[model samples]
Target: MIEVTEKAATELKTLLEQEGKPELALRIFVAGVACSGVQYGLALDDEVKEDDVTMESNGIKLVMAKDIERSFSEGSIDYIEDENGKGFLIRNPSAGGGCGTCGGCH
Candidate 1:
């Protein structure tokens, strides 16, 4: 199970509103190809895949694909905004023994 903080939930809500996609939900995705062993990806998806595990927390819907769900059983995603603007930052505990930002060939 994944957890979303109050700050993160608010950030997501803002994005959804801006995109004018009320049907969209936050999808927590992971891939094994970065310079590191695993990399995380997050996006607002309108459709839930068949192999996805869905959960709703803190008034936000979370979807994790089957392959990613195995490696990313838990993690935290936050919305960060600074001099560079706004973006989603994923803190994945499963990212172990990885290389650079690519998360590949670890």
Candidate 2:
């Protein structure tokens, strides 16, 4: 299972309120791409696929695709708002070296 930081929870709550999507659980998946070889994707989903691992924490439900669960075993989901702006930030331990914005990640 993956852990979600308090900040991330709060951010998600705010997003849900703003988007009018409270019924949706936050879905996290690792797609095959990014400068680090894999990248994270987040979305509000209402249905859990057959290959998903579902967990609930801090009043929020989270679902991670089975294929990405292993890669997400040791990561933290964080929400940060700084000079650059605010959004979800994934601190994955299994990613390779890079800023995840390098060329050829696509």
Candidate 3:
């Protein structure tokens, strides 16, 4: 199952509220794949497909395609703020490797 850190949940709530679509669920998916591993994607979606897996994490609703769920089965979504600024970070143990952008070749 996927988890969301408190900070991440709080940020997600703010973003949803700002979007004026609090009823929409956060959709997470695999956007692409490289030689290193998989890349992720996120968005707010109002429709849930038949093959979607829906769940609540840290009080926020999340949805994902069943076929893409395995890569995120044991991970947590986190919000990080540092010199680089603030953003959402997906910490998936099952992801195996880092993305190609981080000095890794695709």
RMSD values, in order shown: 3.4, 3.6, 2.8
Cα lDDT for residue 91, candidate 1: 79
lDDT of each: 0.78, 0.80, 0.85
The runs of at least 3 residues in candidate 3 whose Cα sits more than 4 Å from the true structure, single-residue gaps closed, are 98-106
The best-first sequence of candidates by TM-score reads: 3, 2, 1
Using lDDT as the measure, which candidate wins?
A: 3
lDDT for position 10 in model 1:
89
Give the TM-score (vs. native) of candidate 1: 0.79
TM-score of 2: 0.80
What tens-digit string does per-residue lDDT give for candidate 3 at 1-106?
A: 7898999999989998998888989889998876567878888899999999999999889999988887677788899999989888877777656555777563
Cα distance off (Å), candidate 2, residue 103:
9.2
Which 10 consecutive positions of candidate 2 have the poorest summed lDDT?
97-106
Expressed as tens digits, the lDDT of each residue in 1-106 for candidate 1 is 7778778998888878898886788887654465555777788898898888898778899987887878887878777889999777887787777555664554
Q: Candidate 2, clashing residue pairs?
A: none
lDDT of 1 at 66: 85
Q: List candidate 2 stretches off by more than 4 Å.
A: 98-106
